[model samples]
Target: MTTTHEISADCKACGSCVEICPNRILQKDAAGKVFFRPDRLWMCFRCGQCMSICPSRAVMIPGLSYETDFYPQPALDERAFDAFETLAANRRAGRSFQDRPVPRELLEKLVEVIALAPPSFPPVKTELTVVADPALMHRSLGLMIDLYDNLVKKMANPVARFFIRRQAGRETFITLNNHVIPLLKERLPDLKSGKEDTLTRRAPAMILFHSDRQSENYRTDIAIAMTYAILAAPALGLAGTIIDLIPPAVEKSPALRALFQIPAGSEVVGAVILGFPKRRFLRGIRRPLKSVTWL
Candidate 1:
């Protein structure tokens, strides 16, 4: 028996597959049709580049191992660990922010870095929306406060009482907003002291990462990309907050979705409010590491 192969009629003969294939196993027939050169299949490395780079998505590999099974043993290297520690140590929840806006060039660079993050599955479909306007930031925060109030009212009586007293005299909404606002103030003293007037006073920019729920790795891809942005922001002298409070508002408010032009079938998975860090870090703090055991 011999292996069989075929191409879809939708193939545009773009030569992308031909150019990308490491093995010369595919050739164009007289009608500009792609075909497998039977003998050349021996040279195929199973790299699947042809399928991955196909713009028409017409390439299919039969009997392909869709999962990556190889796992290298963990090897601890002090230098590498130290390098990572330095990066993590530099990441502080910035509270105070400078009035000066973050440079467009820096934002662009950070996005570029985010684009290189690894996705959990192929064909990652994540989208990012950048909101730099201070007015828009305030509007988003206001909407979040509204949503918080709505949820607070719906909470169980016991839970509601717990939170009400836990808030220490602040309104329930303010208490919820305080989670981010306090961090924002600590990183941005000027904004905290009313020297600057804005919800994200120090942050001249914000980025919202969205992904479709249908994507197999939507959550993973969105989280990875957002984390990359968060880590990269500090290197650019910027601070950011990943807002979990915004998505429900996106779901409940059509006006909010339209304001951001988020497409139908897409959902806001993550949001990062970014700006220059006004507060400086003196050193890293130690945290207790627990909940791990060797089998």
Candidate 2:
């Protein structure tokens, strides 16, 4: 008796398995597609090399192995591109947040979407800290503001002062020993309605993305995850703004680091304050793209 197997037509003919087969048992058919000859099956150690290298994801080894099914493909669609363009056109600093709370279930869903983001390697190694308490959110914002005030008073350069003052409201410095109050104040007006403070608008949830300091892909991995959250927020009828005020505060205060339970070797690369957007953009704008080539 003999057994025969079928090669999936969906195979992209990448030849990845052919290159890696130790026994050279896999061969390309006349159409340059990979196929396993009956004689070569005996030589197969069942190393699963063919299953691993098939880029089309059409390979299956039946009882040999199983892979966890991934959901909600993380790749962005055309609508996402349009949203990105809208963000670029407005060029408005997301200064204020709303007081609306994000439901825990929705937050979990957002995390699920983030989980789909492409990691640096096969096994993703990123961690998330979600803070939903209003008191803590305010405390974190206050800490950043206080640090910003102290740094500004210490700065002596006039140009630096002007630059800081000019962009004051738009930037959020989450690093240690940097003053972020002026920037917060400058952007506050855009976010404020009447006497109400719109910036730090008191969202129901905040998510902090952290990475191991020694991990080669720490920064890149965290960044991609954060981007996933940003894109998915709008779809969920939620809005988020990345805060840069935490890393600096964490760097300066051991107590703060302990409060957030940040490990000694890890750093907070980014933070996103999440909630429903109080203001929405209804139109798109345009700007000139600039480029220079030295050839």
Candidate 3:
């Protein structure tokens, strides 16, 4: 296996790396120079705190390059918070989209912002498949509708319903039986006949977030990444809604999986559908959280 750390000769003996390392893998030698403890090297989650704090730029992780990986932090001001508040307050779930496709450049910008999402650990396991074409989005919505239709049929059978309940647990089973099934049944004919799209809303683009099943925090990471994408979309002349309807369909069908290029064992955690809003909201609605108890 390749080594994880490399301490160059330019070490200034500042002890900054030693103090900032989360795992305390860096230690000061007799001359007070920094050195990595080989035994605890595996504990380093590559959070990059040491490298980010090191004044001498002497520390480098194997997979990270100082020249390419590090960038100067932007200056922050009161306007930053004001801008964020405005964005958050103005946010709306865009279910209605214009009949125009999102440009490839804007999609690339979205991916760039996604890359900056804070990871739960050193390396982010979340993978994104960007479907930039409206035609592909339509096809994907069709696949999702098919899956929901099939699910409703299977759920009608007692034996299959029992098995589904056991596999999906009580909460999910209840959600599907009471909410999802009824909704899908109502829209199935319209969806099949291309009269409407209640799920994907015929968005110009979509992004699927998936990760390996063995990832430490795939769900949390994907959620955060998805939030980042949603928030960044408006600034790029785009708007979107986070949709959960597509992942199950994508996961079950090999054709859908192949179309999205999701790896065989990976789980598609979430999705975001993006496009220009057919209409814009003039005001914001305030929906507070259900509970906010102070400790």
What would the per-residue lDDT of candidate 2 be over residues 5-83, giving only the tens digit for each residue? 4467787778887788778877888978778776876776555556766777654543344255422336787798788
- Candidate structures ordered by lDDT, highest first: 3, 1, 2
lDDT of 1 by residue, 167-283 (tens): 545664565555644544343444334465334434557787888777777877889998888877777778876766566567667777877778888878887778887777887
Q: List the candidates' TM-scores in order.
A: 0.59, 0.60, 0.93
Candidate whose lDDT is highest: 3
Please list the Cα RMSD from the true structure of every candidate, rounded to 1 decimal place.
Answer: 11.1, 9.3, 2.0
CA lDDT of each candidate? 0.68, 0.66, 0.87
Runs of candidate 1 with Cα error greater than 4 angstroms are 1-83, 154-202
How many steric clashes between backbone atoms does each model show? 12, 11, 0
The whole-model C-alpha lDDT of candidate 2 against the native structure comes to 0.66
Consecutive 10-residue window with the lowest summed lDDT within model 1:
64-73
State how far residue 98 of model 3 sits from its true place (Å).
0.9
Q: Which candidate is the best by TM-score?
A: 3
